[model samples]
Target: MSDLAKDAASMAKGSAGLRGAPHHTAKPLHDFKAASHDLSALGALGSLLKATGDIRDGMNTLSALTESLSEEWNAEAKLLGEVSDAFDLLDVLLSAAARAKKG
Candidate 1:
């Protein structure tokens, strides 16, 4: 069994002992208080687990976004390279035209 399951089992056992005890004694009251504190700790643990799940989800989303951005940047880079090549060809053609006109 998991550590969490073991902890929950132990907490349940500890609280169960307080159910039939007289309310007048100091030890049962102390035990009850300790059980209440344990329950509070369990609640905090639950919240922490939820927060951890949220963080995992956020990280997955960020990873997907990064991948999408990388694809887009690659495409944009290819397009820019093509545009640069076209500009270079245009410069060559214009230079040739000017030489032909002069000759």
Candidate 2:
């Protein structure tokens, strides 16, 4: 009798009728496949947009740096032209002084 009681107890413990996790029901295969495809598509689109935004940011930074460098180069060129003019003036003054000393 005790053996029968033990068997009954074991069966009850293992049975789904007792308190435990709920059993899962299967859905249609097409429904699962469609939802999975939609999720994958959305994931790919998100990655593409993120990459585009990164590229746009990099281009903007490059453009700003190029503009900045161009401005510096212009300023340097202007200053160098001024220095060259000063040197030409100095040469003319030296030539006049030499002529005065000789005459």
Candidate 3:
């Protein structure tokens, strides 16, 4: 086997050892029911209000980021247009110079 394959196998075995052997144990039904009930209760009207606030904040952040990106794109586009114009001017100058030389 290749060194890479051997190394991978060794790493897998090491990780398996780290996840100690599994053991079976029974949990009380009341504990499980209470935990489930508490989790559901935790998402009350207050939780909904908090989620709404978080969503509004997220939308504001998204708007700001979008505006920033748009500004950058506009600036870059303007710069690219200028560079293209300069290239066109240079082309015209070069053509004139060539014609003059030929004549």
TM values, all candidates: 0.53, 0.52, 0.52
Across 1-103, the per-residue lDDT of candidate 2 in tens digits comes to 3343444444444432322221221233334433533444445665776764554465556555655655565565555555545555666676788899999
Please provide, for model 1 over 1-103, each residue's C-alpha lDDT reduced to its tens digit, 9 standing for 90 to 100.
4343444455444444433233334464455544543444445665776664554465556555655655565565555555545555666676788899999
For residues 1-103, what per-residue lDDT tens digits would candidate 3 score against the true structure?
Answer: 4343444455445444433221111133334433433444436663766664555465556555655655565565555555545555666676788899999
Worst 10 residues of 2 by lDDT: 17-26
Query: CA lDDT of each candidate?
Result: 0.52, 0.49, 0.50
Superposed by TM-score, candidate 2 places the C-alpha of residue 13 at a distance from the truth, in angstroms, of 98
The candidate, 1 or 2, that scores higher on TM-score is 1
RMSD of each: 29.6, 39.9, 22.0
**Model 2, stretches more than 4 Å misplaced?**
1-46
Which residue pairs show collisions in model 2? none
Winner by lDDT between candidate 2 and candidate 1: 1
